[model samples]
Target: MRYLPVLASVAALLATSGVAVASPAKIPVRVVLVTTFELGKDSGDIPGEFQNWVEKLPLSEELPAPGSYHEVLRYNPDLHVIGIVTGEGPAHMASAMTGLVLDPRFDLRKAYFILAGIGGIDPEFGSVGSAVWAPRVINGGLAHLIDPREIPSGWSDGFVPVQGDRPDLEPVPPLHSQWGDMGYTLNPGLVNWAYELTRSVELPDASSLQANRVRYKGFPKAQTPPAVMVGDTLSSETFWVGARMNRWAERWVKYWTENTGTFATTAEEDIAFMQALSAQAKAGRVDINRVLILRTASNYDMPPPTETAASLLKEEANETGFSGFVPSLDSAWRVGSVVVKELALHWEKYENETPENK
Candidate 1:
């Protein structure tokens, strides 16, 4: 409420209780669902059949395009709950999210942002389609605006000094010659909490599966709860080098970053956004004291060009571009549902206890 501006548009906004009867009262947590499409397609290029299935999900609102944040919220007035697309790379992700965060309407103090989408995983630990979590999200794309050559190669080198009063922004000296990694949620308790929530989700038919196969192998009873191997997520402004070999090389940087206290995964927006948020927290301009970023891997960085040569072949064994990877999409959709339901449950609990609101 403190951040709400007296703008004409906001004045016209009818203030609902900000509490939905379908949810628990005074939810201590605000969950945000963020997705991205590096390939610039709609609905994550989910297999057409799988798209149909995801659409049936009882989401509060659905958007027409991947990067169109405004459209997703058109039917849902609960601005606190929203979605964003990182637009081809990190700059777009930064620009769009900066707009949202700076907007007087967004209650940054109470909201937690979750960055969710597909990502490439380490072969031994994560196969395609298997979900990976980034407890330590690294902004691999960030560097001094002036010194382009001063690219931090690992987490220790990239520990940028955010401006303000908060101790969290202390100018951490670059211990290693790389970028710094930011921890979104270090609470091990919450990690286990999230794992238990989705581990039991039944795996769909394996005949059409692609990624996350080994984790859910033998058709085991959802033993992992849709787990994500948490690490540093790398960010790039440019489209991933489209050659498979090149992409593979770039991933080593991701691996090194993650191994050295940063989880390197790729997305366009999070690096700058995190820097801004850390600055704001230090300045007392906003209180993102409990922010959490949860993202699903949509693709691995540096995808092979042979797998997707531009305009070479329109249709393949699979038309939707997901190939046989429908189940991963299903897994993402299922996880989103659980998040929404849990938000509702929190709302319900809060309202039931409020004397006047009840």
Candidate 2:
């Protein structure tokens, strides 16, 4: 489990200088860790404790060396860990991920990925700041624009067709529901560990946990707690502007009602990021069974932040009055803290119990 520091550092330096280093020594798990700017790009606002924990680890592995994929490398020869910050969005994620996967320098026998960041939650979940772990990833942006006049109101139209289209656009496959079978298993041990670790950090309790547990009555274990909420997530290709975000939110709400589904809105890029990893498994690139996506919501899209007036007194008065009306969206941070802790604890348990490692 130990790597030669001198050798590793020398290798890193050569790699950085456009010189290929000797092939990397095989490690335990080849991990591809990804995060987005949603949690603040600097990583300062991330729970102080979380930052400290990761900083203490020897994750300093060289990222993309010249022709390689990523930038920062927190490599630990003992743990066989290399944490890479794949850039933001699908284009960046896909390009960077593919680079790492295809790079012949590293051996990826036991591939594992953790796509962690913040996400926006549905209002039904009480506040916008809650964290969400998506069990299913759906492409909400693929739906077609259906005029009510063209389709009957009361019918459940599985597929809707588009009207006259311009030559510039390729016919969008009828906006139908496409599901990606990301094989990440719901590790009960990990879930429990996350919950306990989060609790240790003093985060708030899950408001919708119990309710969802009841809704999904067929849940295998009675002791296992339920997830936060049930909402469809919508993804967008462009940086979400205030105006467009508002319109899309309205559209998503209407679509949900019409389809009898409650979807929480997100962007389109995550789909590509996730799809790439899923493709690797399908293609036998690695032995990755599944991946867990932890996201934190950064801003409120619909019902944009009110326009600021020049009058200070008027603004103060308005802010005071609206204080009671606003739902704190910052709770997602707390939830994220807890989830991260749980994973750490679960890993500890597995490490202690595994016979080979022992």
Candidate 3:
């Protein structure tokens, strides 16, 4: 009873300190910009997939993201937009996305997820610095492989369906529960709307990009200027190169999507990201239909006519090695920000209804 005065004084001090007595309500996020990596700090340095977003969108607030790849998330308070770096590769992507969706700090049920990053483009589809909007994300990491020397004579390559004994087996084995699905199809209406909105926006075309583009002698699209287009993406942990592997990718995507998906970009994380988001959507934590994947071209998946796969692979061994590196980053932000800004600026309308419905 004598300590009543002390307890009252402590409560008064705590109140004066501006600390809440109860848990604060979770933040309501309108848009989530997902990038794969960032070089150095978030600003005033070499930009990766995340730097332009952090600096240009000016995500001024920092939120602690435990169990995520980068661990710190950037936020634009006024726009209710959040930016995160998931690191590179499939493992990091799976961990980061799963942690983000399950985090209690943000209300993500109605949030729109924009996965914007750079990828190796298929010269048949587009050239360096081209921006691609993917309606289908195919998983390229789940297949069984055999050495080229051991492969059967008639087979195209060594890759085979995980459950089947041969390549391009009809009725590709049903998606396994343990391995998850082989392909994820995003909302077509929303994807088309986004494409229509930014299709005319010009992409950066540097002299270096042009020089590299001209190397692909027989591919007409490879020589053309970069443009915005709708294409499918393939995600794999292995960074494969060469013409044989490119053919494999094209066939794999066609097989998984029943010849509906055309392979345009080769990336390392989208499938894992989609897998996590799918699970979250099932749990009612996120709306998977609102997810958008935007991949920009930093380099070609296979070598040009005069170059060998080994030589091109060696040239692209580092981040700065790709000719379209900077332009791809610019293209990603230029194209993706249009949609992100639209959703955020008109949150009142977009929150309850996605753009597809409009």
Among these predicted structures, which one has the highest TM-score? 3
Question: Which residues of candidate 3, in runs, are more than 4 Å off?
Answer: 1-20, 176-180
- Considering summed lDDT, which 10 consecutive residues are worst modelled in model 2? 319-328
lDDT by residue (93-209, candidate 2, tens digit) is 777667766666566545445555544443333233334554435444444454435655553432232332321123322333234321122333433434444433332324433
| lDDT of candidate 1 over 1-358, digit per residue (tens) | 2222233224345335353333222212244455554222233553321232234432234433334443332112243355554444555555656665555434555454555555444332334445545554554443323232553443333223233222123344244233434323333444445545656655344443343343343334222333544555554454443334233334434443443554334555556656556666675644443344444443333333234533313322222354224545655666645644454446554223321222
What TM-score would every model get versus the actual structure? 0.56, 0.57, 0.93
User: Which 10 consecutive residues of model 1 have the lowest summed lDDT?
Assistant: 158-167
Best model number under lDDT = 3
Across 142-198, the per-residue lDDT of candidate 3 in tens digits comes to 878999999999999899888888997887687641236788889899999999999
Report residue 85 deviation for candidate 3 (angstroms): 0.5
The true-versus-predicted C-alpha distance at residue 347 of model 1, in Å, is 4.0
- Cα RMSD for candidates in order: 10.3, 9.9, 5.3
